[model samples]
Target: MHAQHDIVIVGGGLVGASLAIALENSGLDVAMVEAAPPGALPPVFDERNLSLAEASCHALQALKIWPLLQTASPIRRIHASRVGDFGRVSLDASEVGREAFGHVVIARDFGEALEKRLGDVASLTRYRPARFIDTQGLADGRREVRVADAEGEHRITTRLLVGADGMKSAVRSSLGIDATRHDYGQTLFVSRVRPQRPPDGTAWERLGPHGPTAFLPRFDRHYGVVHGVPSEEADAVAALDEAAWLARLQDAFGWRAGRFVASGERSRYPAVRVVAERLTAPRAVLLGNAAQSIHPIGAQGFNLGLRDALTLVEEITAHGLDDAAMLESYAARRSEDRARTLAFSDGMARASSNEGLAMRGLRSLGMAALANVPGLRAQVVAGGMGYRGDVPAMCRENAQ
Candidate 1:
């Protein structure tokens, strides 16, 4: 059977689902193709902690997804310091005329919230447990896509095709788009730990020779910890017992959040940077990890991807998706934000891992500047809260 839609999104993960839901009132017929079965969490949703920027929260609020989140810990303050360094930077949301910089939510919980919100989108048709096979451009400027399911192969025709299929995107390959990959050579381990003092709305970052170790506040009174180790030591670190792992984390992170008493299951993710050569091709476009995937050093991966989704929604609502001009405009609008964010994440990953004396001095100076200069610090805060470049309406104040 053949299906027709204004748009067919080929991934129902975080960014893809958010895009589909944000277009709920756009009066467009949309179809979402997800590889995961109904009621099952997507691979992207794991035990990792996600730091949602304030702007991201606003966008989710506008989509009516934020209210469905059962547990989220607000990040009222952020503290950053390096091992064996005297320079430190502390930022409080109140200093910037905001209640909080952002909130932290577990990836699994956020995925559940997205799944719930997606079910309520009246205009969206979902194809769960379906795999995208291939696509071809049609004579009428639309594209025909083949999807595989248990029943058989089905064809879908759409004015616009979205490749939110993530790092290894079939749609991107079919569109003949090339992407560059950069390996950071670091493995990040994430889990929850019960700290003696508990989390008090403070997010801490302790940078070391290997990578950054972050402690984010969680609603359950447990601290969400991310410890990064060199890629060569990943297996050894992962093999550590609970007691040994906790001890290592404490050693790297210091005693700011107090000693970690109890720990939970651990998850490790290899750090790699993936950026598509371009963001759009013909009637197809890329979103989230399909377009670019950066290091999680600043917890900017999902937040940046969400912005990409919301921005595309705005463009689609303003200008119909029938023309190549609309996609070109979308790509141009995303250029600056994408470049800056990619640079920031990649630079942080490299800088923190460099143990050379010159790099260490530069890091110390940078921290001092961020701690002392109000203007510089404000810029950092703005970027941290996801307010850089052209802000999307859904992420702006009083949106919706």
Candidate 2:
């Protein structure tokens, strides 16, 4: 006989874990299956930095997960420019009537914080170091999921099966959901650097011929670095020594922030945009990277995923988890938000990479216009701060 659960979350990373936490005390039997060890950091957060939008902060606060997090540096301003070009734009948080645009935190820190709260939720059952082997859809709106852990294999029948798994989601594969993938032909090198004139709660994005390089404020006067380069040149770029790498970065980004004085270990990932054609099918659903993996140029990856988790919780709580009509409503509500975010991120990546004179001039003009127009600037700030369209109820709760 298979154990039954109200919901079975197939991934235990940020998005999956957030869903489990959001469902706590809702009188539902929930289980999270994670392939990684309980306390070990997942590869997704190994060295990435997260620019948590204001909406994300609100959602985290509602879940009571924000208090456990530390090392978040507030962003008061944003500076955008194209290297060796005339286009420039600056966005101030004060203009938007907010304390700061957003907060930057190490991805690992977020995972650690989530780990601390996971055990506190008495109603959430977690199977660490477990893998989702397969799934079988039943006729009565439930799915039988096979999970393998150290002890042995376990079968779970769940009214709702959420695939929070990453790009290569086994759950999504089992359901045969097709994704439209677009490769940007670029790779991003990420690390930390100490700028001589350290960022004062400001995030900077410098677009160049290769791609965009972002400097997000970090704790202890350091800036989290995300430098994009051609995929063909990634190995060569990574081969450079610390000093040489810093020199290359300076050459690309100019002296906008300041001289780079120190450095840390670096990581790189390919730039790609992947959107699953369908988010929901029968009793299963996809969230986070599994639903849509967009380019990280705009820092919308995790913010978008968190919205997925929060909104799903809202729908499931409003109607019982087994309500097929409610599940359809959940999918409909998410369609607009997901489409807009994916397009924005995909468009940003393309605009930053195209170096044609016409494209460059257009980008410059758009940036300048956005900087000067109050309405346009406000929209950019709002979107950048993760206020893109209707989101979770918690995000709007006490929203500034």
Candidate 3:
């Protein structure tokens, strides 16, 4: 099969799907290619819970997907502390005069909602169960992509090629873009838990011997727990019985969110930091995990990727997709945000994992300062809420 479009996105995950929906009625033909079947779940939309920034919620509402996500839990407050440390900070939405810093959503539910609304866009062409094979730059500046699917091979030529296929992006590989990967030597295990005292729309984060443990509020008196463990200890931790695991969790996290009485199946993945050297190549650009994948300490990875998708669309909507200048401008616009996010996330991982007395004392002081200083707290809240630099129109103004 042979097809042509204004843009061909090489990953139909959250970021790519969001971009396709955002480009609706823009008079641009967009094709989204995904290795997963139309209704199948991608790895990105598994059991893990997503902490959506205020800006992300706005973007979703504007994209008309928010209404479909009924089970999302609003995070009225966030509690940050260190086990055995004296300093702690709590950020409340009321301080910012907003309803919430963000919302906690189960990724699977969000994915189902996105899939349900995908067809409504009316202008998107989805290549389901499709995998990118290779690409070649054409004389006319368009990029040619070869994709394999159940039906067989297909050739797609597009003015712009988007690499949203995740950390090991085929589009990036095909374009010969090198990405630096840093393994954090830790694995994040996530699961659902029923705490004795239900979460009151409060998300809790504690750094201790077990690494960073977070409990996020969810619907129906349930909470989502993310426990980071050293690579060597992941197996022992994951292999523990529910009671034992819950005990370990209680020890590392304390009873801030109350004792965990029950838990669901555990899911885990090794934490890695990946950053691409170049965001643009010929007529192509990488978005989401393809461009950079960071630790989940601050829950900033997805939000950053969502911003990338929005910024790319904004550039294309203003400048034609085929314009090299547009690609350059897009790359430049994303450079700072990407750099800062990568550094912040990496720094958090490093700082939180260090158990030295000096580091512990520093963290305690930092936490106390963040808790006591209103200005510093606001800055942290604002940054974590995705209000930092080169605000996308979709993020700044209500998405309508």
Best-performing candidate as measured by TM-score: 1
Candidates ranked by TM-score: 1, 2, 3
- lDDT by residue for model 1 over 1-400, one digit each (tens)? 7989999999988899999999999999999999999879898898889999999999999899999998998999999998876799999998987788999999899999998888899899999899999997775877899999999999999999999999888998998999999988889999999988879999999988788899999999899999989999999999999999999998898888988899999989888898999999888899999999899888898899999999899898788887568988899889888988998999988998888899889999999999999999988889889988877888885622
| Overall lDDT per candidate, in order of appearance | 0.91, 0.87, 0.88
| Residue 102 in model 1: lDDT | 93
How many clashes in each candidate? 0, 0, 0
* Model 3 weakest 10-residue run by lDDT: 391-400
State the TM-score for model 2: 0.97
List TM-scores for all candidates, in order: 0.98, 0.97, 0.97
Cand. 1 TM to true fold: 0.98
TM-score of 3: 0.97
Candidate 2 per-residue C-alpha lDDT over 77-183 given as tens digits, one digit per residue, 9 for 90 to 100: 88888875686888788876888877999988888898888879998878788899989768566789998887888899899899999887889889989988898
Whole-model alpha-carbon lDDT for candidate 3: 0.88
Question: Model 2 segments beyond 4 Å from truth?
Answer: none
